[model samples]
Target: MRKRLQTKLSATLPPEQLKKIYNSFDIVGDIAIIKTATPNLENAETAANQIMVIHKNVKTVFAQSSPIKGDFRVRQLNLLAGENKTITLYKENGCQFRVDVEKCYFSPRLSHERARIADLVESGEVVVNMFAGVGCFSVIIAKKVSQTKVYSIDVNPTAFEYMQQNVKVNRVYGNVVPLLGDAKEVIQTKLQGIADRVLMPLPEKALEYLPYAIMALKPEGGWIHFYDFQHATREENPVEKTKTQVAQKLACIGTDYRFASSRVVRSTGPNWWQTVLDIQVSGKPSKF
Candidate 1:
């Protein structure tokens, strides 16, 4: 429903904790997911009830039980209110996504990020999403840009299953190709030099798979949408720091590239930010 559903809360939380907990309110499809690092809610159950009362369209509410961890990147959810189901249909950028919030990773916060990448895709381009969770980016890109072919890859079998269904749900079978395996291996064996553009959306694996991302691009070169996380104080620029680090690593590998776009996507923590770099890779990277 709503990414940030605002409402009046005074009794459950003090004035200090209200903003943090309120801002943490997130909804994917009809499921509302609440996540907060602070452990100071006076009446957590009451607050959960309040959400259901205020939002009639919310079919489910879950307290994010664990941090998004592991290779699968799935969130552990504890039912707080509403239906005891983790599956929902999330709509974004004129595209629909069928996702299991507990079994598969999905972020409503990245709705704009997804749209931004799709906008950069030119028609007839062949795209490869290195971390296409549930085929969101690939489906959206294929939907928005006509005549584009997207090879969607994911290692998680569960996510891949959902991805296959989502591609069908969206009716982009010809446009989006779902491949299940480790992206790096998949690229080396089958997808080398096949893409006009490549997307590395998973921040954790983006840097580790940088070389494979380069390999996926055409020899003449193409664009890469890279994501990473960086911590910066109020005085430091996280995006700049991330850019420098990536630049250094890419240089070590002799990957010729330049930034086409870069920005702080979101604040992951107090001083930490998730940054993205739209890099135009030239020629090719050194072979490992």
Candidate 2:
């Protein structure tokens, strides 16, 4: 179905425009997924304007500028919010995350999503964000989940430094540990015991980490937040595809698990969906 939709879209949209739209909405897991509409790519400004119309929830838009010698370089712009206020986001509710667009890799969508997740985390629980981008998830969780200990891991040094700063600024350094390295390597060598909740937000490649996520589960039970995208058929449900992926990965490691709950966290585009599957390992559920 996704392929069919893509074929139809390809006929109507310019190749460059189609590519841009695809890349724009190809939301990386661990980041926020925002809904976007098809844009008329004939005019660059018009296409951008169309995006602005449907994406009312987002106060910022990253626009593509001309490249070197008139090529295109994507640029971020602050959007207008209602009457007198320009959309400005501050580290709210003890969240110490700040994005240095000049030096740091940042995503407005991810930042907003982290804030939302932070609001949902409970105290005294252990949370691990596998792809902790700049500690956005880690800091927010630490700030909100006072009793919870968060281990945020990332392979990028620049991102790790910013994450450390965020933890300190939020005054949750005691609760959040900024680990600098790949999650695959760190999880095996450094982390022990099962986590109350594990966040696998790297949608593009999250399936590959399912085994590790299951292995890190807290014996009796724990929740794994799995995010990814898959092709769906008319008879196929996106949620079910995600479940199958999880199950297959677990089987690869000879582990069994059950879905506690599942829901579409957000939709990115036509046929392309971002779903989160909350799973509990087989057996009695543990009290976290």
Candidate 3:
């Protein structure tokens, strides 16, 4: 889809500026979010206009002007063309989500990962998603499994608000509980020892809050869907490297864990890949 946009844009933008549109744009519902760092703002505006021309469904276009920074994980978006609004309705995996593109962190890229985790969930399972941004993972799990319960927690108030709306929008209702606060405090106060599965989808806090993720699990053991960013060379396998790193941490925390699956979710940059590890951790440890 992006390459088609590039070809469509060839007549309007120069080749050098075109390469800056390198990463392509993300079409979330009627919004087209340009995901690359263009050296010149004008080039991005031109590209955004060209994108709208190619994808008629897109109603808004914005260039990601900054990295996904701070606690909320939201990037600065420069409005390039189309509508000025940031809120849009996005659909995926037979579910609908209302997202505020600037205020919340919503990745269309993680759609596959969300579906993968939902497929692994069983009916009546208790799941706690420690970093459920807009309740993507949790809502999908709830929608997929009729009898499952999901506790979707996020520190960002806006994300949490959107999560609540998304739960209702998808009609998960009693299945998904949207909680607003830090994962550690939420797990410490209310969610400990009650989960059949836990998710650590936010890497910024994943390592620091890992113990809390484990604490949310049932005493016997449960699954941990851990996500992180790792750098690897051409010859190095990013998945194995991530497993080794996760293992070293688990060893110190004193948990017996077996990696059920590992994969490179996406390429964040050259040689830098976002990775995920499906680890089954057993036994509880005092170490935080």
Q: Each candidate's lDDT (Cα)?
A: 0.86, 0.61, 0.88
Measured against the true structure, the TM-scores of the candidates, in listed sequence, are 0.95, 0.67, 0.96
Model 2 agreement with the true structure over 74-139: per-residue lDDT tens digits:
223322122223222345445545544323445555555566667767878888788876777777
Residue 74 in candidate 1 has what lDDT?
80
lDDT string, candidate 3, 171-197, tens digits? 899899999998899999999999999
lDDT for 3 in candidate 1 is 33
lDDT winner, 2 or 3: 3
Model 2 vs truth, CA RMSD: 9.1
Candidate 3: worst-modelled 10 consecutive residues by lDDT: 16-25
Better of 1 and 3 by TM-score: 3
Pick the winner on TM-score between candidates 2 and 3: 3
Clashes of each: 0, 7, 0
Candidate 1 off by > 4 Å: 1-7, 38-42
Each prediction's RMSD to truth: 2.0, 9.1, 1.5
* Candidate 3 regions with alpha-carbon error over 4 angstroms: 1-3, 286-288
